[model samples]
Target: MSESDPHQSGRGRVTAPARPSGKGGGKGVGEMIAIYDTTLRDGSQSESVQFSVEDKLRIARRLDLLGVDYIEGGWPGANPKDEAFFARAKDLKLERSRLVAFGSTRRAKVKAEDDTVLNALLAAGTGVITIFGKSWPLHVTRALGIAPAENLELIFDSIRHLKARTDQVFFDAEHFFDGFKADPDYAVKALMAARDGGADGLILCDTNGGSLPGEIAAIMRQIALPDVRLGIHCHNDGGLAVANTLAAVECGATQVQGTINGLGERCGNADLTTVVANLLLKMGRHARLGVEGLPRLTGVSRFVDEMCNRSPQKNQPFVGASAFAHKAGVHVAAILKDPVTYEHIDPEQVGNERRILVSEQAGRSNLVHKFREMGILDVDPNDPRLQDLLNELKELEFRGYQFDAAEASFELRVRKALGQLPEYFLEQGFRVIDNRMVRDDGAWIMGAEATVKLVVGGQPVHFVGEGNGPVDALYTVLRRALEWHYPAINTVTLVDYKVRILPQALGGRSGTGSMVRVLIEWRDEERSWGTVGVSEHIIAASYAAIMDALIFKLYKDGATPAV
Candidate 1:
């Protein structure tokens, strides 16, 4: 089969099935549930989420590649950024998913054709348009300040007008669940209005996100729309967004609207990654993304998080780093024999891997498994060296060295013990001087200067450098001194630096005297790795971590001294 074949399955590849041809008419009309992604729209509502026009376009392309059925770009009429995104999106050439423009229904006091919002939706130049309208009577009576009948007319007119401009018009019945609880008849009336007005699908939205799975399923069954397709949009306020979405699917909803990693306002929207996994693995439903797209789920999740400049949640469901990690002795032993003994599914199915974590909680079995996995040792479980390594690891953890977050440092320690580590350079000593003064431009500046002395090939070398801070200055001098011997060090960059103060009870007296743990993440062109250090002085701890990072990079690159 060709790479573009929609049925292919593999790692880091998605095979988007053909789009469904028909609209929602009744239960079981279509076996596939449309994965409508709102990551660019609702996801931007997350705190600290700010996507530029380029970011949105990049995400849209990624979602399309992930085989989602629809990608909701943004509210084109809301801001110039969104307008520019739509303008750029027109040239995206998405293969399977339809690009959608989101907006609210026309204002109650205006004609649909004359509404600037609807006009912008048309101007977005997408084939699909989604508009949210008030479903709750309270929103109509208080928020809109319009009569119930007038609200229904607004829903009808808005969808009808958009249907003329586009073949696909999805009506979002905002607060549908809450609206049904407050006034069932009126909520049903709103849905019916959208259905009668030629909406391709009527999405029941839990805007407040307080509805339970049972309540959502019950309400979905009660909604008697046989001709219109039903879609579900839920939030994570109640921590049941995925549950409620699944419940709706079970009750015959055919479309699922959600954001990647559940990014949204307040709690979040439904996490489409979780939704897709559950549907394909548990519910036995067919998706356009298909089982082929499952392996790329974790990659897509991390990619979205990276674009948002957020760390991937290590404990988040199937895709998390710790999802399949075993730390206990008994668990590791059982999993090594048969992973199904503990794991629900194969981690590789989602492009994740089983990891045996070495910690104080780990035992002989855990150590053996971790050693084998790390390619460090494959000796007997009762080997004395294994026990020694475990003891040393525990002692390091007691000193605030977190191997879990800094595996590279842990590996180096193991190599040193095995007498396999090459001494890249001998550090004689280093000194840093900080000077605080006002600049000529009246700006306050803290200048940091550092002098580093190192021995390479039995020859002493001294280097001096300046930076904005002590750590920066130290790294600058070190890099300048080492580049002559290890040119590959230039390719390695410190991508992130984190520090934490160990609790007084752990081992410290007061604020400045407290022991600090530093974790530095380094990335080269090929890969990224983290190293950790712990010491009483913050600068000392940072220096240790920085040295470990450089040594790890050199070791990985096989850098040797010049002749």
Candidate 2:
């Protein structure tokens, strides 16, 4: 079948089937709930996550603007930075969000008034106070070296005393799950003590983060209470933080606490992104948290990742890089017809765009998707000529060219493969040499020699230049050569460069064909783009990638290539 046939027919070529009718769950839309972000306090517990005083205030304001219900700044009295944060936060006009100061209960023998820790909490000037007390008998008797009855007194005195200073008080039963397993009666009594002391909510903390979802549900069912709001704060040591939170909710918890992107100590905290997405779309309910701001979720996630200098997990449920990416021919075809077939939720809802990956596993649907993104629709799906193009893509991907990682280069290649790319300068030959010298002043001077011959608009240009490195020298020579021949050709810059070595599994063997991946970036007044080059030799790979990027930029600017 010729590729032009489908285009000529103007009928359905590929698309998804109609969604099943009458399958919608009733009234699962527009729910109002609070987003309590602890990225400052709890998130800092992540290995090596220490925010400066400025960082803490900046993050707190951002979270406030993002409309989170509460911001857990930090343990007020624990450190100087946290103390400074509390003092600074006092004057900020953070409307619609409350600042919750976190700390543990007072010592076993001290009056809450005289307790330095409780005093610090009051001085923080926060309306809400969250205090954790030892709930597990083992912790009370062994860790704190106090009798279980005395530990109960500590829980009561702390909450009751804090209640006098703050209108809202929450009791965190630390290690509530494990404590329940050890002594169910004592665990229930611990929560009861907090309630009796006028606490607003009983937060059952899975402090060790080792409990399973099924176990969480069973225990929650056992501790079902009718008096106050039941909350769940789960850690991710077992990699089930979200799962346990959901299980707790299903078993009857009113409030859920999690850090955005699951940023907490040990493995991490439950991810509110995943939990809210699942609850809204999968569970078919107005997620306890509203989904109206879903579009801002990705940007918010990125903002925090950047602040923490941590990369977002690529496969993170709704906000990950690969969340809406489609690859395999069948999958791409399905998605093209109907995105809902494979996608659980529309990416636009989460401020993420869908991507069609082109590789060995790709189909012509990938080509169509790419073309569409570039504003070229109505592609011929059954063109026989395009079959060879798909085959070429497969061959290149097999040779270690990954379009998924190097999208800029892939776009240029796609145009070239389709005979739509314009040529600028035809390089006849190029050579580069590198040299270094140690100066008498204890400094090293590195240099490069580059020679290039190129034809631009039927005129021949030869140029030689020196630079700090061989790649730079070659680039200087090429730019000089092009500029000498065609003054209209724009200058290019290498904003970023990356090199990767492909390792073979045969006894840690190294080969002459060690793969190198190079990414070159460029910018103009309007926009910027990154292109990739892959080859066995590092220099050659960089040159190949850089040339492709320059050529593509020229073509995009309506400059014709020199033959």
Candidate 3:
């Protein structure tokens, strides 16, 4: 907050490096820089990271929609899935990002014409090709078992051959910084070889991810010249990929390469999602392409995390769970008066919503803010009921129930305990049974059947259904029970669900008074929302949360439609 520079070229003295021609040239001195992402290639290289062919296609389309300049798919010959992805991506009606296929340069003795990998890359049919060659002498002599002179020939000849097939060829100088440090002459030769070989751009890589930001900037400044466009590819082994990438941009790198959610081998690659957002909104870079719906950043981030089966980092800058989270009494009080006081950027700007964490440290101002978000603007902070709510939060906090991550359930609990929640539906009774079987073919199957009776609008409904889990079976019966009347009910989905057990101390009866907290997230085509429920019985808590989610969806969609 201390510094202010409205110009978009970049913040402070850091400027966008010169880029390869035809990939959108570097903007004016204060113009915003463009971003390129490689989540599909480098990101998926993380051990155990696998994207279904469809998953790869969907993400590539989304990134293109977000206006990224290029999407690096993968090393075609290294994996069957990647090869299939390259083939499938060829047909996408992409308007923004040009699909890029990645691979290493031709082998030591293989001619460009006979190199199997190079031929596979060309057959992938992408207009852009990025091939890496050993820039570090250690890698060339030790890893490749090839002499320095031959490695240079490999670099030059590989680029030369690929150039004839595609005009957009990039040479990724793998381990360029370390290579420059160890043998600056050979490193410079590597870049020079790629340049003469018709490479469209030369990308510097901190392959081992050990270089510091200042070292990266200084080295980049030393090697960058007018003839060759400069780019950067960083890894997060040192937890400084993003910082180093930004510094390289400042020193004169034109293109920035990173992955979504910092996902890659070991620690990860620079998170392109965070990089692009910070560059545009905080650093004042102009997006050359159309990303007017920047709010979708959060949604896309969550969607990718879901597909990867990784929990979203709570404090990941911008899109993490705690990016805009507010706690501490003073901070909450200040934020309630004006969010700008505590929040650096509006969460809504990136498709994220602000969250006021209700905890033991919260004050009446925090309660007022949370109440306002719940659309209860009339709640009096000075009222005794408000004090009671604060006490309840403290009590719950002591019992291991965090409302900050379960806001929906917390809101409903507050209203119900305060006698403010309406009785739109009530459960009469329910029963459940589960079964499992092993087939002769060595396959196993598990199933659950549930029966539930409920009353809505003074009308009783009975339903029964089977499912793969007890919770799922219960949800099915509940939906069937209400489907006839609440016809708009199918629009709801439980995006996220959680369960937590509250601890207690009672010598031998500790579990007697324990609490279970359940959170359910729902989404319609327009927006996403969450609700929670808490009770002693886990199933009861889950059902209560599910009911809250269902009812909330109906209320928002206006089953009546005229309201």
Candidate 4:
């Protein structure tokens, strides 16, 4: 076969795992589910999500490393970027998954052989091709303004044309569940058309994303195709994408189509991170990645989020940061003794860690776990000093210092309490000047300029910086003074910053002097951390957080102070 031949295009093309012949109640590796990732296509449909060809390629490489079975690259003729992506993806050495081209069925009057859509799929040079067609009668008559019979013909001809060129052809029955609910016979006919035309897989899509678990299970059971691979693709419009997907699997669907972090149009698709974890750990079903790939699930989820320039949801199931976090005293006590008492699964199994959040509600157990999380070994958990630290933590929490959201700040305080933290720099003083200026547009604009004096390596240094805000100016000035002694500080940059004002009930004033809390999230090339500061003056509070963030970065990097 030629290099571009569909029969030999993919590096590794794996399909359904064999079903166990003997009826033993063992749910083992025999049930293999092919993971079809459409992050480069469907996920990009999300509002404000526009992945450049390079971004899609990078994500594809990352997904390959994470062991997805099939990667739906994109619709080759849909846009210039997607076409460019397919051309460039050919150069990538993606060794683990089959690359699939996605498109729609042939146009109403267009012949399948000469159809632009089918031709693009073939020209995309992928081993697998997936095309979506209207399964719902409403879409055939109303949306496409075509007769139901003609839509079926489109599905059949489109699949048969692509199947002639590609080794594997997948038919996505768009709105299959809703269509079945509307007209059972017509929906089944649409699926039958694809099957008759030699599609390798039949992917039933919950396009409207309104199907329930029971609905998916009942509909899947009705589609009794012998010797055919059934796939499930769900949307989260009804917040039941994951549930519906699991329901279909229980009803015998073998392939799963989704994005990395539940990213898609509207409410998003079923999160593959959640889906894969549940399949391997809870349901005993297997994906190509299997148990070995489970550990990188969290990393994969976060990698997609990073590519999207979005924050990973901390409360997301399975791989979320707070998935195994404990804050309540009672829960923390039990968790410290036995993690299984609270956590559904070991966090390490998914490349995530358990976090013990410290707050006013926290107890000694919270401190112990927090200490362990920071790798603070040799500390006596029963020591009286530990109680003192807990009391101090509670008092700080009472003063509106949220340690739970700012673990980096908590770690710094705990280290300092143990006399283990090194003082990286001493703040001499800082001044920020806010001025109103008239712009060329005849509008009043506000700007800030800050002067920071700091003693780094025992030498006093001063610097001036300007920005649109006081906090930015301060950070700019401070980073400059510190970077002189710690050049590595340049590697670190601010990721996010948040400020919250305490209410009057929390001992905060109503005016400009109101007590406020600042959270500064920082990131280096390696990892990200957040620090917190609280004070009546916003600038003072911001300075405290910035100082802690800089100190923590330097301390963690093991930078030696010149002093």
Q: Which candidate number has the best lDDT?
A: 1
Q: Tens digit of lDDT per residue, candidate 2, span 1-563? A: 12243212223211212211221111113323345677889998898777887888877777666666778888988998888999998987887578999999899778878999988988898999899998798999988998887777778788889998787888889999999899877787787677767888888899999999999877775653444667789999999999998887665565678888899998899987787677666765453235676677787787788788776788888899999988899999999999989997789888788989888998888888888897766568787646787898787766666777677787776677677776665778778888888899989899989888777778777788998898888877777777654454455566667776666532223676667667777776556787777677788888887787667667777764556
Q: After superposition, which runs of candidate 4 have C-alpha atoms over 4 Å from their true positions?
A: 1-29, 419-430, 437-469, 472-495, 510-514, 523-528, 550-563
Q: How good is model 4 by TM-score?
A: 0.86
lDDT by residue for model 3 (74-107), tens = 8887888987888888899998888998998999
Better of 2 and 3 by lDDT: 3
After superposition, the stretches of candidate 1 with alpha carbons farther than 4 Å from their true spots are 1-30, 377-380, 437-444, 460-464, 561-563
TM-score per model over all chains: 0.90, 0.87, 0.79, 0.86
lDDT winner between 1 and 4, please give it: 1
Specify the highest-TM-score model's number.
1
lDDT value for candidate 4?
A: 0.85
Q: Ten residues in a row with the worst lDDT in model 4?
A: 7-16
State which candidate, 1 or 4, has the greater TM-score: 1
Error of 1 at 537 (Å): 0.6
Cα error of candidate 1 at position 209, Å: 0.7
